[model samples]
Target: MSEFTNPGFEARFTLAQAETTPPEVLAKLAIDTHAKIRRAVALNPSTPIKSLLRLGKEFPNEIIENPIFFLLLLEDPESQFVRLSLARSTTTDEAKLIQLFEENDPDIRCAIAQNPNAPLSLLVRFVQESYQRYDDGSGTTEKVNRILRGFVQNPDTVASILEELAYLSDPELTQAVLQHPNVSETAIAIIQAMRGQRGIPSAILDQLVNHQHHYVRYVILAHPDLAPEHLLKLAEDTELYWDLLDRRETLPTLVIDRIAEKTFQILMSPAPALHAAEMIVLWIARHRNTSIALLQAFASNQPDYLYQHWGEQQFQNFRAAVARNSSTPTFVLRKLSRDLKAEVRDTAKTALRSRKLSES
Candidate 1:
């Protein structure tokens, strides 16, 4: 094998064999031992988790019951490259991997807890158990939050499980996950999990709108039974511009009870119907052949909100509508022209000037 092909091959294989071997092989295995790991961290810090991941699929049950993986991150040469290589590992090595991760040093356990690819069941157990371990109640909430962020990134976990975390009364964990970088669509599950449940208030849901993740915003919008306040926030979160744009057409007509109330309320809520109207107007500006029904829906829902907006294109649009269809009432044109928004008033004036010219 070319030397390039075998980068760190010996260490990888050595790490691999320790996971699979009998007690006899495990001891003889030339791995840098736990003491070695602790000492290494004095110079270079990293998660000391080599033993559990090295075994691949055949890790011994003994190793599973008591993992040696956590010690690796404690060492200086924290080459988690070997560990991260095993991130999505399907190796039947779970028992040993988790045993060490769950039972060992807090730092090792945390590395596992933070891992995006750690087994969901093991991660959840670790998260829950670690919370209890911090019994002094000192700052355990922060610990739980760290685990929630890990799970938030993995989309495949059970919804019920994610919701369980939502039920945790720690405002810190709930709010932390709401804003976590790895957080995305999971906020929807968290919100739904909060349904009718007593602990979380509606304000936290509003905070999700400020998240950089639009998919999380989109998920909040996808909820049919969202609170009026939360719906208002999502409907108006400028960060959700693309989300509303993509789902605008279907949302208005998507089958829901009390269709008018939901649609109208979503469009007129206090947060800023401007988000909904502006996005649609922007879309209409791009695709003039847009379905008139959807366009008309906006016309009916938030025309007042439209006049309040600060964009020139919005006014230009009202003017263009007048020119395109003569039946457009003159009074509607007059209201838009007399509008206080200078850009809008200017555009409306230009439209009236053009209309009078053509008629003459």
Candidate 2:
């Protein structure tokens, strides 16, 4: 029997696994059979611009599904796809995000508010609009509040915006701000004061402690004026356990033990490949009190998956995340300091300096 190896065989095999194949290989596979292979090439971050453009003409859905390609589509300024995708992307550029905010499509505008990367100015504007429409006698208040809730949950929403929302007499709106991850201590204090001498009511605190957003729950757990009963209730929540451990220094001994046990259980569980989980692993790696056992667990799970799998723009983002991580090992920084991307190298050097200063 003849060997199954041929140049065409290699091309077909590599294109079949285009998700991990190199860009040069993907460039060759871009013109391969119509549906699956070309779609794979379109989704591959390393696919060349020419390949993407060719695919765009024939397979716009494939282009739309590829986030990097979607952003490039946005550059056209005339494509309706740009407006639609920009509405959903949390990573679109600030200027384009601003432009999307002004688009005539209210649905698209609402989507921009939902984007995690949406600017604080836009969020503040939405919150203000919600407040203004609260008593306008029209039915717009509920819709405006629904839209502003997205802004409230965004980490980018500034403390000033949260503070402003806290002053509003609407209990639901104020409660939403209190659950924000970025809500300042000063804003919490203002909210606490608004509730009168008895303290934030159990119902509101209960709801805030159970907020779906981890960062929001973290903020609530970190609040100095938090009610003792609320803290105990929050400590019992398995979902908030990591955030609780992340603030170990402030937690009571019993709470710390619970958090540690919960964290260890999660560590022993099968790890997921989700980006959010990977980020949490990196964060736990940075904590000063994280155990050697946990560090060993993370050694194989370093956030460098991005560097291995992503194209230029996404790789730079991964490098930036590593640079910002204070606990990123020195060896990693040394390697990153020589990265071809100037931003990556500069950020690495800056992080190294910060690490040195902190050590001293």
Candidate 3:
């Protein structure tokens, strides 16, 4: 004000405005913009995820009903916040959805089945409810495909829903569920679930071995529960097993070495590819010690390896066995502590420190 050129005046003015914002006023203003809501809720998730869900629920019906909006936030940079936010929105009963399920109109049933943010419990409940009403005339198959749309969009969560369903199901439904077309992400979840339920038909495992989707086939191949026949089949699916090299991060440790070997083979084939060489190094870094040993024998001539894989964030929401007890003494803890990727290293260290402090 003195010279109309005070360098820090704008900064001071902004701070004063922020300070003057009443708690209620600021909360209201924070709710006005989705991006601002994201920032506010991220700063204060301890408050509740529903703070932003209120914003989503305020939208016009058309906007609320748009699958693309859900899809957008599914991959949104602020998606984790939005997901937590919407996760608390009210849940409707299968009763509300049942009539829609019976409607001859596929779109209505599609809508009934495909609400992107529906809870897993709701999905499983509706599947059962819809099946009860179906009786060969209820059009359950069409609804299954509609539900599958949700499964494909967010496979990780839907997989858990499917797993929970698998546990609570009779053999017929469980059998059909495993063979569902979107078996990509659900295979591992279902297998992990069957540990207690013991109802997953062996046929599902066999079908998983030859499943069309790459993810389904790879997960089943990596299963410790796999019988010798499954292993023998994978060993013979030479071309298919080699294809797993394309996505080694999702592959479990059991087959990671095989995938590494295949990548090396593809790299050295008569026509060499640079991507293959680079990816082999990245795969080696992920599975680390054991795969590193295999890589040395597989790619002795490969140049100095500097892998730039960043997956720690996507992995945060999924429950890993290593995360169950929150202990840090395990081998994974040591490997992750030294992970070259900054995100992986930081999250691992944070998790270990939190676990130590909690145990203390």
Per-model lDDT? 0.46, 0.60, 0.44
lDDT head-to-head 2 vs 3, winner = 2
Clashing pairs in 2: none
Best by lDDT: 2
Candidate 2 lDDT tens digits, 263-347: 4445445662332433444445455444444333333333344333433565465555565555567777777788787887898
Which lDDT tens digits does candidate 1 get at residues 1-360? Answer: 242232354543443334333333332232444433322221221223343344322222222233233343345324443343233233435664575574455555655555445577766566556435333345455655666665655555555456445534456556655554444455544644444333344555555444334444554554444465554456555545455546544333222112323434455666644335444454443343334443343333345644554344555554445324333345555665665556656655776787889999
Angstrom error at residue 147, model 3? 9.4
TM-score between candidate 2 and the true structure: 0.32
* Order of models, best lDDT first: 2, 1, 3
Give model 1 RMSD, 1 decimal.
15.1
RMSD of each: 15.1, 25.0, 22.2
- Count of backbone clashes for each model? 17, 0, 0
